[model samples]
Target chain A: MTPSHSGPSDRLEASLAGFDVPAARPPDFPTADVSYAVDDTPIGRMLLACDGSGVLVASLFTPDAAAEEAALQRLAARISPRVLRRPQSLDEARRWLESYLDGGRPGAAPAWALSLATPFQIPVLTTLAARVGYGDRATYGQLASWAGRPQAARAVGTALGGNPLCVVLPCHRVVGASGSLTGYAGGLAAKRYLLELESTSL
Target chain B: MTLPPFQLLVDAHWRDVARLAHALVGPDDGDDVAQQAWLQAWAAYPSLTSATNLRGWLFTVTYRCATDAHRGRGRRPVPVEDPSLAAAERPAVDPPATASDESGVWQIVATLPPRQREAVALRYVADLDHAAIAAALGTSTAMSRRLVSDALGSLRKALS
Candidate 1:
């Protein structure tokens, strides 16, 4: 694949653009500079995994390596247990993620090339990618309509709620029907900051 | 011989349980898996004298709990109806890169079906050894290796 025209990377980038981890993200998040990327939300920390070419996985407050692994397992089930220190690939991703946390934006805006298994998730994520505008918010009902199922407002909310990529998927941008902010795995405060960043950027 | 040691073991490996459980189930459902594993571990802790594979033991409990949980629940309907995956919202454009470079690799990885992804993530990303991986996945070592090797070969072909 010469990279799908609007590959999955764009979906991830659009989703996470505004929501960096909080300023007090996590002092122990394998790095320190991102420790201050604070936001007001349920999520205490954020983890962004990029292969330099594009982001792969972005998790919020996954906690630690254990948490990271858990997230990875959820992403890829039925694991093998080989302990090789050097994996021969992914160095670029490691650097990209480091730069993302170190408060530096990537130098390039590349396309993603990961295979997504979920059928409904891609379009839902695509919608999320487009709606991300820092602090801007959209309602589940609205997203439901966008996904071609206006009656599935609740279902939309549930899907957004389960989004694993947190900031990367920009699920934080979705709110309640009554204009109230609903649940956020990374918390509401973080959501607010993401909206703020996007709002101000525009 | 005391509850404290068992408690310590549970606490020490609690995170691993959570990780494996969460991977097996969603993060929300992972709590249940962890809880069951701890109960099982506590019951088995008195005789768990050798300290070598404590992590593996705990993980196995978690993985089994998750599998049982899933089996008990029958199976989740595939194509889990969620429109928000595409319809949710996007963040404002930023300079930071959040894309990826593993379409070929993970596409094949994804093809391993879901169970294998869970095992691979637990094994490689979690740095869990074979025993731990098997324990966490609730499968035998041979099975775990087969899935992994199959996934790896798939990834290589995808990349190539």
Candidate 2:
């Protein structure tokens, strides 16, 4: 512990150095359960989560690193007990996301699997995903009607708020009955960006 | 209060875990140990109560995985038949850390008892403080400090 003339510990530190910690690699877990990766886009960082079946969740990342991590962790724990950082696992999701951003319609409707949620939410989300095409907007009430629940506009909003597949499922297209921009999980600004991105198609 | 997500935990200590794995097991086996630790941590993540101890918990998992591989080598059939396993054991081809003055220190430390080597590696290689080291080793802080001190003493003598 004494600061001598560059003693044994210092010598050891100097010599056994340059471990060249490799560029961070996606972790490969024993069984391919759940994997996640972050993609940087014009909007900001997007966190994508997936399982063996298909892409599960996509959300605008929180700026705060710790908070973002916790949010993803909670999602993974609830959705898939085993989660890891494997960007390669999300290759397809990344492709679709990039295409969508580039004003290209996703080459195909993405394969998707939803985590556990309310029964009512499933039909509402499914109808929204199918009907709300890019550059298109639907009122919450209309979405409710499409799902065969004409009086459940508010519930439809609630379901959209908890949407696991935000951009991918087109949740941002849902608006208020008056055509007013409404609440979005990615925030109202992001909603505007998406709407503009689709409308202008530049 | 909700705990920080597993992704954050992995980012924070992944490098440390990787280095510790390399120190305990050689390069090839070290990578395997770290990957296994990530899987195990994810499975056990929900059950974790104190979020503050995430580093310690992860390191503990990494340590266990490394030890398991060590034990496996002694008991199981020589994995040398597998190309990857054979590649892992080939030190001349796969030198992870470059040889230097400190390299001798590791060579010396390798000769010590397992616990002491672990103590030294966690302290020096992983750069964990005594408390974190103790937590990872599943021992009291005092014990961890003593182990590190003893290991250093031995290292100094070996160098002399």
Candidate 3:
């Protein structure tokens, strides 16, 4: 179907000159069972995913393309594989995130989807969210005790390491047993930045 | 090779895929077919071995979805409203006076046998090369060339 071919194909192409297929709008497209967005923030590039109702996961530090793909693959396996990047759908979450990162108090917290969390991890994360406030820090041992597993400080660290909600769930607020900055999925630098951000906001 | 973000794929080829869907199934079912194609593509994307021929991959998916829509058409209830009414409601761009003649050409293209119609659409509408068309249609490159030539022959005869 070379355009230079001066014959029936050209004539056919000419006849189709004015034929137009309407451009599709975002709403006209089907809703992905899971929609995601990536944003660059003060700390690092973050990957966020949500079902229509609530956020499924947020990666505070998306270091590379492979990390993004890994998060997407996990979402596809656990939820539905029908995922698309629709940033407009995530405006509210972004706004809240920006506000929180800027050291300003955000409005109502975004809804969370804990489907990715194990049962123990769920309780551990819930305790962290409820008991830990902004500008306040808790030791891992304290968090484990608060979650009713006083002997499971090591388990609590493992759970927070895989926190699906990241900053939104306040996992960064949990410090080491001795109150030193320690392992965070986003790395220690991000954890320190988050901690300092909260302390200065006080 | 590391896979690129899925969003990039959607951004790059959505318009082409939409146009292909319209060419295959007409405007009424075009959006539905395209949506199904994208959803399926997303689901299968992570496991995709190569991102090298993504456009061809997308067109292939759209073709399969269009075919499925055709097969299921008889099982689905027919729309009670006039199809023209539905077309009128669509957000069509401003068409020139030659719009009717253009549509007449598409009508001719549509009546061709399925393979020929697909070949014509992939060639003219989607603006894909013979090799890309072959990849999408699962045909040999020589076969795709023959299909397009035969389809154009039919179009020329009908137009004359």
Candidate 4:
């Protein structure tokens, strides 16, 4: 009897592998309120998350695993702990994104989940998402005024700095007062790239 | 080190948990047991101090859940079917010819005593080391090795 050799244990391992286990479904409760996925876009690998109702949540440019993990932790802390990485679940957001990045306008605005935003950031981001088009650019002061907070340009800038939905909310479209490209979550180079992409398509 | 995102844990171990559940319980109850284990794990995740052996910790949770499920259903003997008949009766895609043989092995595994069954599942299904299996099963490392060896002996004898 080959006690340590490939026998019963080996057979058992192969048998176990033969069982057809389905993918675990997302938990039913709010604990798993957010589903996320990472996809490679023209800019970089971007992490996209959606709430239970399929509202678009965080869309951060994650260059590496550490960045993706950090964004996921932030979402879990701010939204719900039951965040699962289900890529197929984020299909609509990904489709919209792919279309937009391909220089074609997505049909409609995907619902945004601003759970990570403040009361102030909400209106600022909402205004930006609704008013800014694919190739349009606006100054931070113009965005603040559009959001009906004329005196809060700096606050608007701060709000855009922490924008949860990067490309979806068009944070890159908000430039410095003199039309110079300002800071972007994906960095200055990405901001320039996005701007160039939009300009070339237009 | 800080707790990594709970999603990472789910992504890494959900399949192992499901497979362990099926081995401990049966196919009918496996999904429910795995789901229960993940929910419980999520609830208790914040208090988990060490992330070093999360696989062991996850299997421990799954084992407890499977045991609870068994107790809830009054510990009825999981019905065993004739392997050839079971394989032939599957209406889905045609299973490879070896599937019947594999299912026969699984049926033998399913008939072991509870502790030996768990030892076998953790050892082969989850692919954990003896020490890790011991940690999940709350037994000594020597005890884990003995349980697995005894179970393998039973399997070989039964298969022969």
Candidate 5:
């Protein structure tokens, strides 16, 4: 039997693309129809998904193990078949994703529409993104300090751990003060590798 | 019986979310992202009107949770279980690329810290742009870029 590539994009594109209309179906709530692609990065192949939302979910080297499970649970927790709409922009979205996978950096974003509701989280995220460097690392306590809630180190950890967006946010940059990589949502090994990369290159 | 909206949404995005959890926080952190994301989804359930696109909503919630978890907030500690190596109903694996010259990629990646691994995987494997990567790993675009860069550096050195 031919191995199924990780997703239906190729087949879907071939079959569905010919028609201007997508395999349009009434939205399935408890069961949103999902589509995704993979972005090959210098480190590994990342799984890029566009659920019914215009926003993308990128699971880095997500593998077939625990990471995949976590992504599903996260999706379950956010919205349902009752509320959000499935992707109205499949062709545009798929093309955009293909662009990124092909390493055309500008094409990483969807050309048509996206409605991400993460305004409430910009402050802490902004600081982490701006202040951290490629190889450098920060501590959870420091992140709390930056957020002006110095005592909330663990709380910050919670936020990082729950980040719906994974690599794009750089939560891995934060660590424990002991210079020990602690509590990386990805895992300690990934954390160590990040810092190691930073120290060596950036 | 119709699957609960939450279950269906959860089921569809399960693999993606689990991959995010494993790549960013470590296998240990999956529960936290999944639980808090669920809690957030449940809390915001009332606001949902269209079911056509629940995937983004779930990603946002868990992305927020992951960010919070990274910052030392909103973690739900659960019992740890050894990885079964093979789950009963996992997505079928791709046929191995026996000919790709860049072999043992995961092996080297596995050697990095969990955070770095997450960054690396999210960027390299998942192919998320900095924005989506930041959301899952709970950081920002530049920071996310750096993490991936550094991870690549480690791999480069190790492979050398």
Candidate 6:
């Protein structure tokens, strides 16, 4: 990057002209509470994050390391500050994922943390996790009723839109009121693949 | 008081922190210091009641980290000053030329005291204003200005 100034420090500028700054991220705290691991999956690179409480967040990988680090930095900034790469910490989740990929039921969802951005989202997410079974589907309107807010179909969509626990919470099983698959965090194609994977096994 | 979103805070100040760090610690360690500053900022972000100048606050953290790294380097001496090791330690951008004024200027910068070097680098390489440099150095703007003036005077005398 060119120096912004046209001052008398030409020699000083020349000394630092070619210096490249590495991408900056939030510093790790002494209390390394949040642990994350990136793994290759049938879909793509995925980040699995867990904190002292439990597994809290996951993200689809970006194209390269810098982008991925930036993405994880964002996650760490918002969710928790101490984000460390601990592959062994995610071994159980990885096993569950592998089993699910190999055409087997994931029995029950593991203990994942849910620190939603808003309180209203709790009931909506809980209702989805409880009512939407494997190979089964629910319309947004149905999920709203299950959440005890029958008139909140739109809010239900918003809640699922921000779902951090993607496949584990089965947010992909939620559909439009007309039974059409709606937008998913993992693109529609991945959504279709997940639904098909469940349907065949059922 | 509720703080502005952490993402927004980082987006606004991260580059500035990195630039200042690079000036203080050189390229490699500067990057590491910048990253450490970000992590520290994020960790303390929630407790920030009211930051009138969040960018300056972040830069202050970065400055401390860079200075700590510099102090650590002082304990373990590198052979950069030795002519025998000149070929290995020479920076690629400006090759070592004995008779050039530019080489003389670089040498002058190398010989400057630690605080003077940091103040000069912040002024020239980071292109930071007196106010921002003051915050990073944990000094008043007037003091920062004096430091820069003193550094420039030394450089000019050596060159003349």
Most accurate candidate by DockQ: 4
Tens-digit lDDT track of model 3 for A117-146: 789999999989899988888999999999
Local distance difference test scores for all models: 0.49, 0.70, 0.74, 0.77, 0.51, 0.66
**Lowest-sum lDDT 10-residue window in model 6 chain A:** A20-29
Question: Which CAPRI level is candidate 6?
Answer: incorrect
Q: lDDT at A146 for candidate 1?
A: 80
lDDT of 6 by residue, A117-180 (tens): 4588778887888888999999899899989999989888988887767788888899997889
| By TM-score: ranked, best first | 2, 4, 6, 3, 1, 5
- The CAPRI category of model 5 is incorrect
* Number of the top lDDT candidate: 4
lDDT (Cα, tens digit) per residue for candidate 4, span B1-160: 4666677887787777887787777666777988898888888876787878888888889988988987787763222222222222222222223222345666776666667777788877777888888787677888788777777777778777
Better of 1 and 3 by lDDT: 3
lDDT of 3 by residue, B6-48 (tens): 6657777887787777777776787788889987887787688
Q: With candidate 1 superimposed using the best TM-score fit, by how many Å does residue A38's alpha carbon deviate from the native? A: 16
For model 5, report the TM-score of its A chain. Answer: 0.54
State, as a TM-score between 0 and 1, how close model 3 is to the true structure.
0.63
lDDT of 5 by residue, A28-63 (tens): 334343344444444454454456554564344555
Sorting all predicted structures by DockQ, with the top scorer first, yields 4, 2, 3, 6, 5, 1
Complex DockQ per candidate: 0.02, 0.23, 0.22, 0.28, 0.03, 0.17
Model 4 DockQ class: acceptable
- Tell me each candidate's TM-score: 0.37, 0.69, 0.63, 0.65, 0.37, 0.63
Candidate 4: list runs displaced more than 4 Å.
A1-32, A130-134, A144-155, A197-202, B1-5, B22-57, B68-112, B119-160
Q: In model 5, which regions exceed 4 Å deviation?
A: A1-47, A51-53, A57-70, A80-122, B1-160
Output the number of the TM-score-best candidate. Answer: 2
| lDDT comparison, 2 vs 4, better candidate | 4
